[model samples]
Target chain A: MMAVARAKSRKADEANNPSSQVLRFGADKPLILEAGVKLAPFQIAYETYGELNADKSNAVLICHALTGDQYVASTNPVTGKPGWWEVLIGPGKIIDTNRFFVISPNVIGSCLGSTGPASTNPATGKPYGLDLPIITIRDMVRAQAMLVDHFGIDQLFCVIGGSMGGMQVLEWTSTYPDRVFSALPMATGTRHSAQNIAFYEAGRQAVMADPNWRGGKYIEAGVRPEKGLAVARMIAHITYLSEVALHRKFGRNLQDRQKLTFSFDADFQIESYLRHQGMTFVDRFDANSYLYLSRAMDYFDMAADHDGQLAAAFKNTKTRFCVVSFTSDWHFPTEESRALVHALNASGAPVSFVEIETDRGHDAFLLDEPELFSAIGGFVASAARAKGLA
Target chain B: MSVNSNPRIDLQVVADLIPDNAKVLDVGCSDGELLELLRNQKNIDGRGVEISQRGVNECVARGLSVIQGDADTDLVYYPDNSFDYALLSQTLQATRNPRAVLEHLLRIGEHAIVSFPNFGHWSVRTSLFFNGRMPVTKDLPYSWYDTPNIHFCTIRDFVVLCDEVGAKVEKAVAINANGQKMGFSMPWWFWNFFGQQAVFLLRR
Candidate 1:
């Protein structure tokens, strides 16, 4: 759909211009892994909008979710649609590209423009595949720190994201407390709940069950494993929507049929929607990349990192926090977000929390929810004033 | 930090009770003027919770960290001793559960500063005694049907509640219609009738 946008970039030289392209880093500054390994010559695909002011404090890092790439306010190259959060981070929008510099980078494990399992291995002269070091949220953040340093920015005006993106935001705040002026983590939890992990495992299993997967070496085997990946996507998509949203959108209505055919084909509108979502997702996302990112989320445990004391993770943190949760988001419910707020409070870190009443569920952060927009707008504006951007 | 030279007398009294540089939470902090005052002037660490989104927006606009939440429900989320002081100004009477919120404030902070409109004031009494209608005054301006104040109480009633909840009243001040502090030595009945508002410093 957005083929035109991608086609133009190939003809244009991608030397060192800071518009939109893949920039390889971490060679001289290799990322030391939590697994006691080193990932060198790695690359990060990122896109930047607005202008970094002279003081360089106007930079706002926008982290994407598990499947999202670095298309914050623009059209996604894969789907040709406006970026997932254009409602929140665009010109004159809440994040306000007109006022602040925005940077969105594809996470390390994802398949977009970033180095992932699909990237060629410099050592072996083959696809890295499963050889790509398992990345944690912190690893993604450390890479972002490198990107921010590339711009000569010492501190960010704000680090904002939702879902897994929110997890990265938290990691950024805890890891580089002095660098972030304000943080907004929306519809996310500090750690993946057992139930959430169970769901992710289900998706991972669906990917693994495919004979075409070839045990994570599908890229080198020249196989797509579309079936298992589609099943995974279908299962994962259900968690992102609330029962209310599902009922409102579909409500058992047949998919372009007046009556059920009584076959294995989709009879309900929700079923057809999920199938469509699955098919479209397989066209863009990578199967092994999905496995690696999902596992990364399951492995995330901020409290466990701080010796089981969540407050210790935020000891002496100066970054102001704004945590948001939606009412019907059972996946990462309001209670989960409150835990982060409670930890921040115990550490005496300044934090604000809003449990927005919405039936939109986990995906509410991606949608055009007015409360989220206003809250983020007010928060960024305030942080900007405090950062001397006023 | 140029402190506001003139603050609302009730808020000024509330501000005086907070120690400099102490962490504080202001429940139902409408637009966060008191939080702004304490944060800028005394260098106190303060956050706030306001039920209305509009109030939260305004507070955030002024660079005050305020969350949109209800004190009655959200107070229980904070850990014990999270703040040095918990300030509730002109909000106690309007709470859905005054006792529970008060208990949380006292438990969550080393001390609490609670200020509310005195329903037993002489004007409200005379209006009820003579006019025989739900008394409306500058303090309790809302009529019975539309007021957010669900659990209205007098100064004496709040003092009774403190004892019931095992919280000691460290200091209590009553302000009149003109915002002048009344003598503490006065009898409860006299203060209840004459005072327009009451401020209390409580500790467990």
Candidate 2:
């Protein structure tokens, strides 16, 4: 369903003149990654709505998910779609951008304006590809912190995200406890589960198995791995939704035909819909960046870093936390959120939790779920009051 | 008197028991009226555990820290002495094991505040005595088969359970049918028969 916009030059142009502001850090201020590598002379592309108050306490950092970019509440220049979280963020919406200064940064390892596998490497004058040092969730948060520092925001009013973005939120609260006033990590977990790693492995294999992949050097080859990346996107898309959501959207109904044409073509409506999702995703997302971001999610285990105690990761943290999950989200289920709440309780952190009842599954965080909106709105308002914000 | 004044009376009593700047956990805090009251009046840091998703949502929308959790199964996740007070208002009887849940409350907080409808009130006793069936009054409005109050207890019974569980009653208040407090010097049986509901403050 998407126009073919997979050319290397088009993506490079997006990197050069991103739709939003870009913050650059020279070799003097290198980002020390968790992988024991230093990434210098990098830049972070971000979008800002609303104004930072005099005290700078009104800033809210919005971290995007695995494939999400910095276009949080504006139009994306590449795909021409509305910002991913426009449903919950705007002038008078749930997050209330009119009052709170909202900042959304394209992560360091994503295919967006950020320096990812698709960005030109300073050393070789080519796309970093696999040469880009592996980035972790901690690494992504560290890079965003530099952007926050650029604005002179000592502490963010709130840090919010779902799925992979949620992982970054947790990392911010854990690593830089004093820098965040409040945190909302929804539809996520402390560590990637075995099942999550298995699903991502299947998607990564799909990308690598295609002949056009060229061993992660497809951009230099002048032929993108369209089929491989499409298959990978399709595999990951199924995990984002629940079986009930799939059934409700597309049951056993045929794809615009009187009877089944069972010849390996798109016979079922679900098949056609999945194909559209995959095809649309490859146009905007880079294939090798997908592999790197998913691997970063796989390596995220906060508890392991803190001597096998998740509570220890948040020791003596004064930041208020509000954890949210969906009932039908088996990908990152309510049980995972409960585990996070339990850790926060053990650490004596001010925390609240809610498990929203919805059939929409993990993607419910991104959809028009009123209950999620109310929960986030209420929590944000209360936190704002606590911060003495008008 | 209007009907709403009475419930407010006991809730006010629960709010009065807490001090300023205290960390409070309101177990079974349906919609968080009591916690909200404490937060506004006493300036206490309040948290809540509600059993229903709807109740939890409503509580959160009011800016109260609430989680959807069953009192029977979820209290074990809390650390010891985490709060200044833990409250179980009108929700103790609905638990599967009221004794164990009470023990958990005491363990999780420095003090526990409990409130429940007394089954030995004259109206409840008279209904069962004359009708020869489970009582259904204004306070206890459900039949035995459909009632969520499975582990029902009277004022005297709760006091005995508190003693059995090694908890000392720091303070106790009994509210009569008209939402008036009974005499403080009265014996347990007098409050058990005359009082409609009771609120107790206990500590280990």
Candidate 3:
């Protein structure tokens, strides 16, 4: 089955004219990690919405959340759906594609044409599976920096993302503060809490419990652990929402008919919603990639480099930061964002924080919230004007 | 020269009160216009603390050295006696803990310039007494529920609070709504009769 998928992908690549392509940078290969492992020939899949200006000052990097692809404002060829962030990025939208060069890349450890667990290892010509080197958020930012350097962008007008994408945005500022002029890290924390890591652990356990998984070699064994992957996605989806949002969106409501079937089938609207979420997620994502990405998130502790003082991590940062969080996102609560703000304040860094009132949970950053749009739009516009882009 | 270039308060009053070449901190320094005036006109070495990111960006765009920080929570980062004067023009009333903050300003600077809306002015007083509701005057635009000015203070109330904190007043100037200076004798009535704002220079 693995060989068949590869053959199908090759045939599709040859038969179907390329509508889009991922641009490469650096030495055309992945660099070795500090963990004493080499990840060679890794590629980044990216999509661009607008033309780069002559001076390249209009370049803006847009980081995508977990499970999100590089398609920012274009239609995704896989699902035949509109871009995930179409509402925020368009000709005249808040992000304003007409005025900015937007780049969204499928992050490393993701399955969308990027090197991940599912990608074949050149050494053995088989999927890396559990053998893929554990990549960190900083590693992702380093790859992105290479991409930005390839584009000849000396200074990014702004780096913007939310959730895991927001984590990358923070990393870009800390690791390459001179390159990033402004940063908008929305609905993200400096590090994943123990509770968050526990959730990821539970999801991984759910996937491994399925017999078809066969210890992460299901693809080589010619079997797909769809049920296990779906269940894992279902459990993870529950964490991405707030209790208020769940109550408002589904409130013990029945799925089709008013009466409960009293059976094992999905009886409540939330249960049906979870089932749909799980089934759709399994279709596009690789299960092993999910494990790798979640582990990467669990290991993400930005302050560990600064001697356990989060404020010290930003002492030398000169990038203007706009930290935003939703009121009802309990997964990465407003308190978490406040902690980041407190650190920035202690470091004497220029920072602005706005906890917008919303019941959209952690995913509010992706939705069509007028308040979020206005805050980001206003911040970016001001930052651009300061950089003389306007 | 232009109507838009005029300061929100009496420019001459601020200039007269702020000493020449004194290190000054301006909270809520919108657009850095006041800071620009202090730098070019008064020749004061001015630093600003503005809450709005847009405001801070504008300040930086104008080549002014300003930090983006909230006066309510970010002021404690500064060391004691960091500046000769801390100016809170039309911003003290908006703070969550105005009394404690005024004490902090006095502790952080040799002197403090505290200015706010005269809530006990005739119009606001009448509005609440006669109309039986929160006043929505020019100085206070939002309704009570949404207003950022959580602690409304009057000129007389401020003077009493300053006395209680052992802060001596160097100069107290009240201005009419038209920005004209009012005489000291019954200035509240004169302010009620004509003035709209007040500025106080205090010494600890």
Candidate 4:
């Protein structure tokens, strides 16, 4: 009877949200998640590029940041924009598609065809809403492990990501020390700072206060909390940029005019930019998924797992790490990355760090900056040669 | 077609000084040119510590073992006697602390080979005397303000410092800027008057 109800609930979700693309895999099959709650009949959405070698030693797993889906190098049907990291994941790009078998999965608690609040509950015949068990970054990694197993890959050549994606990269190395050969965690922290959590809380409050939220049951009512989600996106977007970048891009500039209109109509260029950002973001992302993912980030604390010693977390790791940060990124400053490097060095792990100079803020990792690209390109190439992958 | 075949490196000189099939570490190993020559031509196991990511990448791409690290900070990571020789050809003057770094290098490897531009060369002296400014010669291209060569020393100054620090000079080879051997039969004053660079093999 439980199986029948789960099938019915899945069918309802399918009717409401159509898949942008089919989920495909190789010979080995997906494993059931082991978080105690049986997502028995749950499915993961992922995309792959390049061919798997006969020895299967060339696979690289890319963990995506918050609001990123599995379509890494493909078109986002909703936004019609190129893949979030198309610059870094093509045929001859740094993470070369021709040489690496790459896999990127839509993380759990996301809206891109993954199990989340929008996913239906088997028992209630409705959305999970507030009923879904709270998940942590480690839980997301555990789910990804199931996907890794499905590919029959025992070890990954490298696990790469940035920002929230970087959190998953660190978790991969810590949780599965023997399974990762190299890790590239860029523009990220070992734990979210108190200030970051405060911003997340503000965004959550904005979404929850909306009348259309309907106590997290707006899905059944056919109502969308667009206004609150936009506000939340606007606030979070400010954190993604650096003060230097803001000053350089839009410093006291009037919006499409030489002078202010003397009214509250987004007269400043920065305000207009923020409004566009908020409006465009609401077109694709689910408000409830945003709340859940941010909460997951808030709960992440790598040092807590090692008896309050950050070095202890990496004591047994044999994985070579390349921890990168940007100089202008106040979000995850170079100090945080240096702390991770220091911890790795204290634990006797082979680690390297590069704090690249750039005004692109935290988003520098995603852009086509020549220096960052060259650094990553060079590091991966060197690691590949060391592993005999070249 | 190997990059090691460049005319700039004194292959025969470095070859005679470096023992065959020895563990070697080279600093400022630009493009892994010298390390590759040592590995393929001399049967030595070579590693390097380079500051430039591109240079380190090139080394690795050529199948060389090199770490991307600053010699200023990363040298302490290695244990004592980690290599048979630590080669710092034409790179010693560019380091942050030439004296202290040489001591560390000698402690890390059984022998250390250091080569640098002799600031007391006759052409430099002539240029400074006549022009009344820092000389921009063939070897040291940058002016005083922008030059990375912070610890420029004359051959006599380096020898005196080595003696003061109790470092034994195993072998010394003075060469002109074009990498030709200088005749040792001449007086020290005459040699210092003409020699452009000097390479020294030291042991503690």
Candidate 5:
């Protein structure tokens, strides 16, 4: 019964009640997307921890990655699991909720209580599906800026994130330089590379190729593209991991039987693990949302918007930046982060660049990496000192 | 401890040369001790380029602006005369091309301060003459096979390179084994024979 209910309301229900605090922007304050579409009656769902100081200068914005919601350091109502970034954000953790007011919002165009393709279009009184105007990283950040403005926070103490979230962080700095005192953009680049675009294209193709996708109207048809979305998730999941990590975790290990089945069954533990990953993802994520979000990432090119010089994007910016990359993260390799650091340097911005020694690939930022913790912890403490946060 | 024998004193000499509030870049800034010192004491805007990941991490932990980059390759990215002072301490010998690195330092900063161990010191010459093997001293700790100091030079050789690079020496100080600077009146041959290390302030 629970699975049936979850499957039925996979799209609209979450757009209404996604398990946390939500902010509703009426038609009077429509979000003007970069594509020149004004989205009215939009809502931004978010979660906050710690208390805002009397001066309101201690607020930190934590941007979520693709498919990550606002449940930064708590339980997820849909997944029944801990928050994605709970490892680094707790009372005494690296982010240290006790010290700073951390606000994590579900970015616009994502399906977790934020206005996305799954939400009702209001124009037709039905799910927007593919009708929703395509959202860019800048659009997502602009919505977040409105959310921050609602709190009367003139300047965020820091803005931090990894992967897609990291892209948002860069956008935040570029779009509103004075509003961000410092930024930590980890495991991401200033622009998505061709390889990354190819991977995302493959995922999008898998979802569209499914018969149940119904021309992206699956939610209205009462049938979800579970099989296609699962395949997409499986393909994307592989990119998030490295060959070393894969070898270390499931080195040709069989799943229950001693020998191969010689059939189309999940013979290897890796295959079984990927299938489980795919199935669980389909339960909480929207297929159209995935297509939209991946498309948004592919369109991210900060340099192109700034006269083709990456340094021009940060000309005379005062925000302090710390760019980090993992040694084994092939998805967003160390060279990408180096490019960002070089741009920041050329622009005469105060920046610190560190490439951590890790075998955990792009997901290392979300794992128990002591070096990463120390680097972030130390950086935050120093920035806090500089910001005069007691 | 004498200025030439103590690494800390070597950094102090380099630190003493720069004026307060100057924009400085420390190439090969290992762990950022000099940059931190300059930031705190001189109140200068400081940046660093360290080749080692471990060193870069340590610098970031201290809240110093640093990047994981080689002095040889990464220095070209900076625009000319971007910094008031460029410092190279105890690291010039390790660079693949010392002449090019020195030229870059001069080009990137209006003034460059460099300090290096003098290979023409009496002890290094005697060690090679008697033992006929590479010299191992308190300053140069590594054996010849494992040494990172690839290009060793004397005080006179450095002066000649400065001339070749078209850098005018504003100030030059040669320190002996006793941690004291040799007399300024002494000739280049005398300082080359007795001086353990040398520090020079250069400008184009």
Candidate 6:
């Protein structure tokens, strides 16, 4: 019944937004999800750049962080803005679309065209909403693996990502160690820190607090829950940046006011900036999808899959690894990257670590940091040499 | 030691001591010149830890797999028996606890190759005895205020440190101020008195 409702919801969503590029898969060989539910008749929306070599060894998978979509090096269909990672993934950029085929997909539970809470249930014929089973990072990777399998590629030359995307990179490497030639997990940790979980909880509460949410049935109830989603994005955005970055970007400067009028109407420049950020975000993103994706991030724990020994996740893994972190990123600091390096060393896996000197915080990987690019480019070139690619 | 005829003369000896295709960790590997040589000449799998950011950048630019890390704190990250040899060329003197560093090196690798400028060379003694000031020889050229060699020791002192740390000296060689390797038949005391630097291969 819920599946039928989901199918109906998907049809309604399709009618509302007719340009969702998707790849459909039958339920014959469902990607076994962590929740023990075999989802079939599912679809994954993805965008690819460059050409896959005859051997398919030059394929590179670029996973995305929270709120990032598959439009990696192209214009976003929803926002009309350039791709999120344009700096890192382009024709001659660090990831080098000219040299390697890059694939970016909207993860399993996201607002971007991929199957998520907004996606219809094949059984219930309505949006899955609360009916959709909560997903984990491993589940997200499993879906991506299915997408990779569809392309008939035996092994990827490299898999790289930052933040939540980095979590997927690690999950993919651990779950299918032999399939990934090299792995780069930047600005991420093996497990969600307690503080991060608290932040996510705050975001979730903010969404649930709005009456327009209508118990997550707002779409069918003719409401958008914009206020709740905006508040959630506001709180979540603060975590993606550092105090140093915020101070530098907005400081205490007033917004369009000569002096302190002292009205709560965004009296500070930072307040006006965050409000603008929150408002623009709701225009393109869905509320329920945000909740589901946030939960997935919270559920991620790599060591849990290996019986509490993180090193065991990469036991004798032949895949080379390069872990990266920024100095001022308090959310995912260099210490987390060192822990990852320590685990790789314990597993006897060959690994390289670079703690880039940056004050841009956790969002540094998505920015123009020359050191990050050089480190990544150098690692990729060396790995290519090892893989016998020119 | 800037006064030495060639700072790399001791590195040449270290490169020769290492076998082909061996797994080596070069701690405090500034600029990774030795690692690059080992990779090309001996086909060894080399990794490096350098303290300075500039050194790491140079190593990376040269296609060396090096991480920016201090030897005093980062050695604990490497697993025991992970490398066939651990090299600390001209770096042991700069460490805060030389004995602990040596012990960690022995535990992490099958053998530890260490080289340091010997403070007991005759020139250093002459400066102390006559000038009543710290040596300004080719090997120990820096003024006391600017010197980074905080735990300077001689060949005899290092041998005693090895003994106390339960590390057996597999081999030893001393290079004179002219950068010539001293004869193996020469007593360690003779090398201590005349040689400007000493290199030792130690094992637990």
What TM-score would chain B receive for each of the candidates shown? 0.93, 0.95, 0.90, 0.90, 0.94, 0.95
Predicted complexes: DockQ each: 0.39, 0.72, 0.15, 0.13, 0.80, 0.52
The regions of model 5 sitting more than 4 angstroms off are: B1-5
Best by DockQ: 5
Query: Candidate 4, residues A1-390: lDDT per residue as tens digits?
Result: 675345434434542353543343323443233345545344567778898888888989999988888878988755668888999997988889999999888887787776777777656888887777776788778778888887899999999999999999999999999999989899998999998899999999999998999989987886778789999999998988988999999999998888878899999989999999998887678888899899988888899878888988887788877777888898788778867876775565656566677898988888888777766776688679768996
Error of 2 at B24 (Å): 0.8
Model no. 1, DockQ: 0.39
Task: Score residue B172 of candidate 4 by CA lDDT.
Answer: 80
What candidate 3 gets wrong by more than 4 Å, as runs, is A1-20, A23-30, A34-36, B1-97, B106-112, B118-172, B183-196, B201-204
What does the TM-score come to for chain B in model 5? 0.94
Ten-residue region with minimum lDDT total, candidate 1 chain A:
A10-19
- Candidate 1 per-residue lDDT, tens place, B1-204, comes to 001112256888888888789888999998888999998779988899898867876776676777777898888877888889998998888888899999999998999999987878776677788889887655445778998878889888998999999999999998887778899799888888888888999999
Docking class of 2: medium
What is candidate 5's CA lDDT for residue A90? 83
Q: List model 3 lDDT by residue over A1-390, tens digit each.
A: 785576436423311222356654334466565456656777677888888999999988999887777888998776668999999998999889999999887787777766777777667877778888987788888878877877888999889899889889988988898898888898999999898899889989988898988888876786667788899898888988888989998999999987989798899999999999998887677788889888878888878878898887787787888888887887788778878877775665566666777888889988998766766776776677668987
List ranges where model 6 is wrong by over 4 Å.
Answer: A1-21, B1-6, B136-147
- Writing each residue's lDDT as its tens digit, candidate 2 over A1-390 gives 133434456676666557678888889999998889899878889999998888898999999999999999999988889999999888998888889899999999887778888888889988888999999999999999999999999999999999999999999999999999999999999999999999999999999998988999988887788888898889889999999999999989999898987599899999999999998887888999899999999999999999999999999899999999999999899999999998998898888898999999899999999888888888999999999998
Off by over 4 Å in 2: A1-7, B1-8
Of the pair 4 and 5, which is ahead by DockQ? 5
Looking at model 4, the pairs that clash are none
Q: Is the docking of candidate 4 incorrect, acceptable, medium or high quality?
A: incorrect
| Candidate that beats the other on TM-score, 3 or 5, i.e. the better one | 5
**Docking band of candidate 6:** medium
Assess each prediction's global lDDT (C-alpha) against the native: 0.83, 0.89, 0.77, 0.78, 0.90, 0.84
Candidate 1: regions farther than 4 A off: A1-19, B1-23, B30-33, B36-44, B51-58, B68-84, B93-111, B122-153, B160-171, B177-185, B202-204
**Whole-structure CA lDDT of model 1:** 0.83
Scored against the true structure, residue B168 in model 6 reaches a CA lDDT of 91
For model 6, residues B28-141, the per-residue Cα lDDT tens digits are 889889998999899998888888877876676566677778888888878899999999998999999888899999999999999988878887777788889887665456
